[model samples]
Target chain A: MTELATTLEALAVHKQFCEDVLNMPGGEKIKICQQCGTCTGSCPTSYLMDWGPREIIAAFRAGMIDRVVKSNTIWLCTSCYSCTVRCPAGIKITDLMYELKRLAIKYDLAPKDGKAPAMTKYFIDSVHKHGRNHEVELMAKFMLTKDWGLPFKFAGTGLKLFTAGRLPLFAKNIRGRDELDKISAYLEAQEAKAQ
Target chain B: MRYLYYPGCSAEATGKAYDISTRALMGKLGVELVELDDWNCCGATSYFSVRELDSFAIAARNLAIAEKQGDEDLCVICNACYTTLAKTNRYMAESAEVREAVSGALGAVDRTYSGNKPVRHIMDVLVNDIGLEALGEKVTRRLTGLKVACYYGCQYSRPMGDFDDPEFPVTMDKFFQALGAEVITDFAGKAKCCGGMMMLTKEEGALRMCHELLKGAHDAGADVIVCACPLCEMNVEGYQPRVNKTFGTNFDMPVMYFTQLAGLAFGADPKQLAIDKQIVSCDRVVAAIPA
Candidate 1:
């Protein structure tokens, strides 16, 4: 129990995580959570894990940042934002999950649910190269880490799309690659701080 | 006033509704959508979930292009593209090492990324900039009896803030409200993932997640679900039949864009919303709208 309580201080969790995060731009109104379990109850991945929204909030309240951050339960969020609407309290657990995702990637604590953010670099590279999101390249790169047919079916769609002029073979490259670098640096600094 | 408009792949493809309506609405609001000349996909969902750096590069390519165009504010229409581009930008802004690596990767190219723009979701435009006043004027036909369920997909409002209130975002509802529709606020999923890319990969789980959300909306008596993200609209629409098949439930609530709904209420042809393309028909739903 002593170690279970180490991640965060019970009192500071809401203030730091809930309040502070909710104050951010895309955030706000997360504190409106009426403690309704609708978020946990409706979470698609809830059945797949041991932690629920209330429990996670309880954990957060208990200063279990380490536990919360380290727990695979955080990875369960598909970022659907169901709870954000259902919650009478209006806590943006999804946004919290996003924060946790960035942190997990930084701390190497993310799960292998095939959605690990570790693949972010490759995905980002593909976008930078093409100025758009290409599922084909993304599929091949992701499948490289897993099985073969992981991207087979999508190939048909990709072909159909390309032929229909829905997708261009080559990316229309953007010009300010340098500013993107600076922006990346600024954000990386914040991520480091979160870790 | 001049923002770099990155119309992600879907907006150019499956999200024609979004593309057309967004352009139309934004034009009415005095916003211009300048498609990045040589733009590509933002390496949305599948890209990063697959490989990290590659996705970053893909996202960066657009950033570089936007920078060259000298457009600082990048507004994207599709949720996936918006999320991908913004996420990559956020990541790039967050990681010095990644920044260096990505910069080094594109060192050979003349185009560079400044990453200075606040990548915006179009909702930010309607809710924030246009703010009811501009939209209200365009509502030639107010949908007095229309019941709408607002769906703000995950990336649209998550990651600790960017634009809307993630917990209880009302841009969709507001869009409907502006058109005189009744907003249905129920216990259905609002900010949850629609499993956009997950649809083709993991149908069952994805459909289930989407099912629950759509079901909740239907259960709440929503005539239609209003969404900002094109992927959400697509996923909800495409897999809707599968959901009805899986659950044996016959609810047929239409999934539509906030702008599409606005366009309809404004007396645009119901065809404008592309109800025919949708597996879940909006006929009864739109028919229910007060004349």
Candidate 2:
């Protein structure tokens, strides 16, 4: 094992990660979670999750960021906001999930061959290239880079959609490319400063 | 009613039917929707998960354009766009740090966001600006027997609950009723999630959620599922085959945008509404609706 993994396994929890989570937008509210499991109960995909919503919050409070981050729970969050609305303590569980996803990307913790992270990266890449998201290009890149089997898997649906004229041949580009470029650079600089 | 239309990326391609129906409905309702000039993506869920500021900035660019255009009210058709635009607008107006940083970013592009502009979804405009009574007056074909499960899905209600009950919203149900359709009240999955972005990344899990939604509507005896969001429609309608394959249950529930249903009720041409473009055939819905 690497030195970082050895240290992570030795510690009860990572204090710095706990503090980081606490610092996020909906992070502070997580302290108020009572482990009622309302969020998990309301979640539709929690069954497939490695760590349930309630358990993730408990892990966050316990300072076990490694357990929460290394798991596939963050990637599986659909951002439904059902957990947020149903929380008696008013914990923004969904927002915290988004924050966890952001942190997951920062640490490069997503599993190898994980399509979720790759899909997200491809989506951002599309926006960076074109001012708007191009679904065809995004799908093509995702299939090419992450999952080569996807194109074959979706062939039936693709043919049906293409025949129906639902799939466009090219993505529509927005005007004022320079403005988006400037805005992206400014935000990148700001984020670097925050880090 | 005049508004700036921000048709997100989905409306142009995958959700083109939604675009057609929205335009048809807006035209029939006598509402003017001037397409927002040079509007870009809202960064969807992906951008925000990668970098928060960039996603906010991208959405803010669209808001800044509307702000410059005399700050006309922005109407978004996609639920993701509505949520992202509204969330960014609120953050820009409420947070000094965000406002200053975003303003500095916009200044780099020679644009500004004073946070005076308003962003709303089509449902809000339909329910508030154009009352249901006025809509009822224009209905030429009342869908008296059609049973529709008004599915709001996610984002439309939650993380922001100004327009309707986030949990058990009746705005769509009531609107469908105004169009003379029997709205299904016992739909268990009315406010459930359709696994939005996961439809691409996690197909099996997304299919699981879609199956439940379809089964709920089917169990409730709904002839069709009516929704306002493009992602919800695509996930529920486009993936019905996979959902059935995953669950081993046969479900042929047709999903249509609420605007399409409204367009049909207002006696708009079916072709103009793009009713035939649906992945899951709306033939059942057509067969049921009187000519």
| Candidate 2 lDDT tens digits, A69-126 | 8778888988888888889998878778877888777666666678888888888777
Q: What does candidate 2 score in Cα RMSD to the true structure?
A: 2.4
Q: RMSD, model 1, all Cα superposed?
A: 8.2
DockQ of each: 0.16, 0.72
Error of 1 at B114 (Å): 2.5
Candidate 1 stretches with Cα past 4 Å from truth are A1-43, A49-195, B50-54, B272-275
TM per candidate: 0.66, 0.94
Model 2 pairs whose backbones collide = none
Range of the 10 consecutive residues with the lowest summed lDDT in candidate 2 chain A: A1-10
Model 1 chain A lowest lDDT segment of ten: A1-10
**lDDT (Cα, tens digit) per residue for candidate 1, span B100-190:** 6567555544446765657778778666776787678877777887777888887776643577775666667666777788888654588
Worst 10 residues of 1 chain B by lDDT: B45-54
